[model samples]
Target: MFRAKNLWIIHLLGWVLFMSLPLTIVSREPDANFPMLVLKSGWFWSFFLVYAVLFYGNLLVLTPKLYLKQHYAAYAAVFVGLLILIYVSQPFEKLIFRKFRQEQGREARPEMPRGGFRNGPPPGLPPGEEPRPMPERGRAVDFVSLTLFIVAWAVAMAIRISREWRQSERRAILSEAEKAHAELSFFKAQINPHFLFNTLNNIYALAVSSSAHTAPSILKLSQMMRYITEEATEHYVPLEDELACLENYVELQKLRLNAKTKLDFNVQGQPDGVKIAPLILMTFVENAFKYGVSNHRESVIRIAVEVTGSHIQFFCQNRIIERREDVERTGVGILNTQKRLDLLYSGSYDLDIRNAEEVFTVNLKLSGR
Candidate 1:
């Protein structure tokens, strides 16, 4: 609304400046009569009305409906018609000015001498001499009118085209933002179900054996589920909250591991005031436990996270022991996490993964808020 009001103010100022030129010229005359020469003149009022219609009609109607629509032939036809109207109407100013001069001559004339020649040469003129007629200003007036008409037409087209271009650019930016939002939502939906499925299977194994750890595992699962359903729905969560959730998950996974499996988890630096994308770090740790643990052969899995100011660093490595088929399924979660990082952090994060023969490693760095 403010922008529209400003545009109207600009147009009003421009027309006022254009109308001032004639007033300035008339004021320079020796016996200038503002009311008789300008205010009462039919030509002055007609010029204002006609050009106003031309400028606004072209800007609000013709340019958008015809020129912008690629109807060049129809646009040209209408423009030529307006020019013809201007040409035909040019004679009005000349006729009005002539009538004013005749009235002035009658009012200023002195009483003629008795018996003197009527409508003849003046007293000082030589015999057989007639006065020369004043030079005509009709051509000059026509030229000025034509020039102003062209200027108004050009300015109207320029303004309309510029406005259209800006609106198009705004629409394009809005469309891109909406598409990115939808893609990020899809990735988060995939991560939630994948995490839940793996954790449930571990609890089922403990329940079959009637281990004492089974009851405690169920309590920890409830806490994790509460975090997922409530806090994880947000795009970003406090670093401390995410860390607590991760600790709960690690403890639950430990209940299913044998003494031969060695696992190390570590965190460095204070998490105060730091924020990170929800559930962004869980996929890598889950992959380590799924493929790196063994019941008979010795196995090791390591995970570490460090925070320094707004920067976060994560590293995870594990000895691969699962079958080839299981290792192939690991790509699903990792791929989805990578896409989420691109949409959320884009240039602010980096991730590297290596699947060697004996060990698989993941290193990720994030610039957080």
Candidate 2:
């Protein structure tokens, strides 16, 4: 967007260039007295003023109010009317020039010698021949005036159309950004409730069993909730903060695990200066716990995260002990996360999922800014 001051500066510079065009043409003439020509030629000054008015009128009013609004007949009528007005008014300059020439002739007559002929042939002319009358310059002047008028009209139209195109492009970009922001917020809202529902269920099981780990599980839930409400509300959070939240969630899930279930969680790398989209990795961990744990049979779930500078690699694998009845309903979290990834990471991240008969696996890679 151009600031008001800058826009005015552009307009001023454009008009300066427009006004200099006449000076440029005049400078090419032999023995041209530029200042005198400009001062004596009232028609040239009037021409400049008329075209200046026409340029602004077309730009500020005619184009926007008539041509752009599809008032084709009215715009054409107005254009023809202006042309007729110009043609009719131009002869007044000829009259003014003729009067000026007569006055100069009258002033010079008294200075001639008493016996000298007033209308004699020039010295270079043949003795019996008369000098040819100078050709009328009106046709050339009219041609130049018409050309200027057309140029003024074209320049106005071009500037207005170009500005309108730029503004339209900017508006489209802003609207798309706003829409993406709204979608990301909606997806985050859905994720929060879904995550809370599962965590509360885990805490409930511990409470009903009267297990000694119930208090610690509740404390972990409190910390995770605090992180969600505070740090996770932003589009991105520090990698260490997200890892701490995930660790709390994992510990809470461990309270319900029996000796028959074995889980391994590992993380390697310093997380300084690294950040990621919040809660993007939690859904995979939640799925591993939901269907991979068994009370009476051997079960194993593995989760690993490796961070190197601005790049992160995550892996999760689990044995599927319980089969899902409604595939669509069970895949909601995954779908939601995928949408967020598309919006946030776009082409900067990769995700792969494998669902085998006996095992489920997820591999994700992220490149952070």
Candidate 3:
């Protein structure tokens, strides 16, 4: 409920009421004794000077540093110590000035009528004497006020801590979100370079052999380019479009492969109006070609997609070579893809992988929504 500007204004007003007002009010009153009057006025000024430094220095200036922790004990110590110093210094100041006055020729003291709030006398003191007792500063009431003020300050500190905690939590969540987005973009970027390189290799085959399928290969590449530009960036695209792209990719792969390697693909559910990532399945298919199936005799690859109204499942199984030295590999694109899946689907997707029986398999289930 408090702002820095408003709190500062309130502090300034409080200073006027407590310090300036009291000194100004007492100064207008006349005292009964010449020496007593001189002594009292001088004492009030001395107390005010000490009180000013302590109050302003601690509350306004030092509060920023002390705000680190709720150090009520330190605040209390400063307040009580400053007040005690003010109380003791007042009487001694009077004695020193009185001695100075007699040493000079300014000892012609004149008495005046009593007036001020302490016209009778300062409280907690005997009748006119050399050592007068300091008056009550509303002792019991002040004790209660100081207690309440301490509690209020602690409450303010608690509120500040809570606000900072919430802000930090929000920042952490946002940073995680940004990191996931970057990973997704990196994965998407990987898809392009790999696709382009494979297509160029296919084109090289056509140039080397003078095959008639070169024109269709060019057409398929164009379609894939269009998909990447328009639909790939979207979170989801029509399932039919995804399948069509997959079919194009398989045909493109066929251009470079021999008749020994064959691909089996199946679909069980409606691809009419459903949606999915444009290239999520393509990576698995390409991986199957790259690592799963070696360029050898009797190679087989299978891809199946089952799409329901509320969920979708995809499975890929391909044969791997037994004698390959590097059996396991994690490419940049795959790492980026893993991070993307974590952020995009989180708990809504399940992925299982197995390389048993010399056959690599991947099964993934993702929420449709």
Ranking by lDDT: 1, 2, 3
Give the per-residue lDDT digits (tens) of candidate 1, residues 188-288.
78778878989999999999989898998999899999999899888789998898899889999998889989999999988889999988999899888
Question: lDDT for each of the candidates?
Answer: 0.82, 0.81, 0.66
| Ranking of predictions according to TM-score | 2, 1, 3
lDDT score, candidate 3, position 325: 40
Model 1 lDDT at residue 275: 92
116: Cα error in model 2, Å: 20
* Deviation from native of the Cα of residue 299 in model 1, angstroms: 2.9
Q: Across residues 1-369, which tens digit of lDDT does each residue of candidate 2 receive?
A: 677669888888887777666556544436457545554666656656788799999999998889888899998898889877666665323433333345435223333344445688547777876555544335434444556677888888788778778889999999998998898888888788878998999899989989898898889899999999999988899999899999999998887789999999999999889999999989899888888998877889999999998999999999988666545645987898998899999999999999998899999999965
- Clash pairs detected, candidate 3: none
TM-score of each: 0.80, 0.82, 0.61
Model 3, 121-233: lDDT tens digits are 44675766434344544422233223323443444445455656777898999998787667777788878777778777877789688899988888988888888888888
Residue pairs with backbone overlap in model 1 = none
**Which candidate number has the best lDDT?**
1
- The clash tally of candidate 1 reads 0
The regions of model 2 sitting more than 4 angstroms off are 1-4, 27-33, 36-45, 91-141
